[model samples]
Target: MKLLLTSAGVNNKSIHNALTDMLGKPIASCNALCIPTAMYGHPWVGPGVNAWEFISGKSENPMVDLGWKSVGVLELTALPSISRDRWVPLVQETDVLLVSGGDALYLNHWMRQSGLAELLPALQAVYVGMSAGSMVMAPNIGEYFASWTPPGGGDEALGLVDFAIFPHLDHELLPDNTMAAAERWAAGMRGPSYAIDDQTAIKVTGGAVEIVSEGNWRHFTP
Candidate 1:
């Protein structure tokens, strides 16, 4: 599986290039599915608009600006109302799975409920994750969030990757995103963790992991 887990979306040239390299083709020729399910729970605890802007990538959304032929939103929460067979193929056909950031627990719910988790291993599409999207790929979120938990009382993540990601470290606008907070969070983790700013990403391909950074990032264990 190919995955690009980022604190933010493609925010710099290095990340953009990493994405391009993974695609092995012009990004404009690709088809993208932008999942915004995580954003649904933003108001309860988040930066609101700023989170939206980062997820949306505004009018300059790299997928659009870079030339992805088809880009659309897939609300994972709505999966139950639709035919899974029909929707599952759409995921398989995409060149990219653009998962937006928001509440990790919320997003994890839809991923499991929607069967997206099951489909991921076989997916040829590059999995591009932002913030919460990146976090959900781990074994468990535990109290890394400090203020939240899954509604169903589970800390389990998708376990798509061996480690957890703590995003938005040291971001100026989001006061909670600091190195100190990251240190606290990492200290509680049961396994490896990565603390990354907006311009950083963790790329995993065929079991090899690489840190792609145009900004600050560090790996730690608790």
Candidate 2:
């Protein structure tokens, strides 16, 4: 699967271009699936207006709003009650997956439970992730970003990508997301990590990783 992991959802032209490249076609021609499951697990963004905003394309982030041929919801929590044949083909046929931000561990839990985690590696579609959606691609999000932990417990996520991410760097509302704080967060990580602002994204295709950014980002080596 192609990955376009962003601090915010396609916030800048560079990131948008990267996503286009990953899609290998125009955004208008592609079909997208929006996943809002992560929002419910977050303490601040659970089961209300935030989830509605994301699904309706009215959120501050720009995932579902990106003008696709069609946009559908793929709520992870609801997958268990349904059979795979009904939804698996729907997922495989989609051109991309627009994942929302909220809680990384929580998203990771449902991804695993919903069998999406196992299906991801073989998927032909692009996976675009915003904030915690991007963070869940990492091995672990670290304790600092942990909220709504899994029943088994820990900050561990999908581990789809080799590195970790600390999103929303230096945003006004998140007072603790400064470079210094990011450095502290990086200290506990076992592999490479990145602290990126809203205008930045990390693109991974066929095992090659690249940064597509219009704003600030810092890479830390372990």
Candidate 3:
């Protein structure tokens, strides 16, 4: 599977170009499945979804533009009540899974409960994770933030990626202490870890990782 874990949105023209090159088509040219509900309570959800609007040139819900045909906007405030069978077709048909930014723990909890943790890796589609979406793939979510309690229980994560990723570093848009917290957390890790600045991303393909962009990328290995 091809995975693009970006620190933020696809706001950089150069990054956008690189991503299109990597994915082999204009982002808008491909059908995208956006999980904007990942950012549930954030103010950015509206704007972030709007950004996808500009990207896809569709004023309607950006999720629709991604070719979902039927966009499922699930409110994961609690344990998922929907059956996994209902999402099977959508997951199978999507060309790209675009998980938006939000509270990492919350997103992680929902993904785990929804059974997407297992379903995503088995799919044929490309996975595009941003911010909180990126964090869920790591083995642990503690490095990214203090703690997040989902409605059902304590929030761990899906553990898709083997390493921890700290996104949105050195970006004024993030909380002032985020970077420091990540640095401290990474310092104690026993496996590979990354602290990616806002403009950067780490693309993992065929078990190899390449840090992409013009910013400081720090790696920690124990």
Best by TM-score: 2
Clashing pairs in 3: 32-66
Tell me, what's the RMSD of every candidate?
2.6, 0.7, 4.5
TM-score of candidate 3 relative to the true fold = 0.77
Give lDDT per model, in order: 0.81, 0.93, 0.65
lDDT of 1 by residue, 1-222 (tens): 699998867878999999999998988789888887776656553446644553455623353345588887787888988898879888888999888777888888889888888989989999998888889999877675624456778677889899988888888878987888888878888899899998899999998999999889889876
Cα misplacement distance, residue 129 of candidate 1 (Å):
0.4
Candidate rank order under lDDT:
2, 1, 3
Identify the runs in model 1 with alpha carbons over 4 angstroms from their true place: 44-65, 146-148
lDDT of each residue in 37-128, candidate 2, tens digit only: 99998888878999999999999888899899999999999998899998999999999999999989989999999989999999999999
User: What TM-scores do the predictions have?
Assistant: 0.90, 0.98, 0.77
Model 3 lDDT per residue over 110-178, tens place: 676666666777776777778777877777766336345667654456777788887777777566636
User: Candidate 2, residue 212: CA error in Å?
Assistant: 0.7
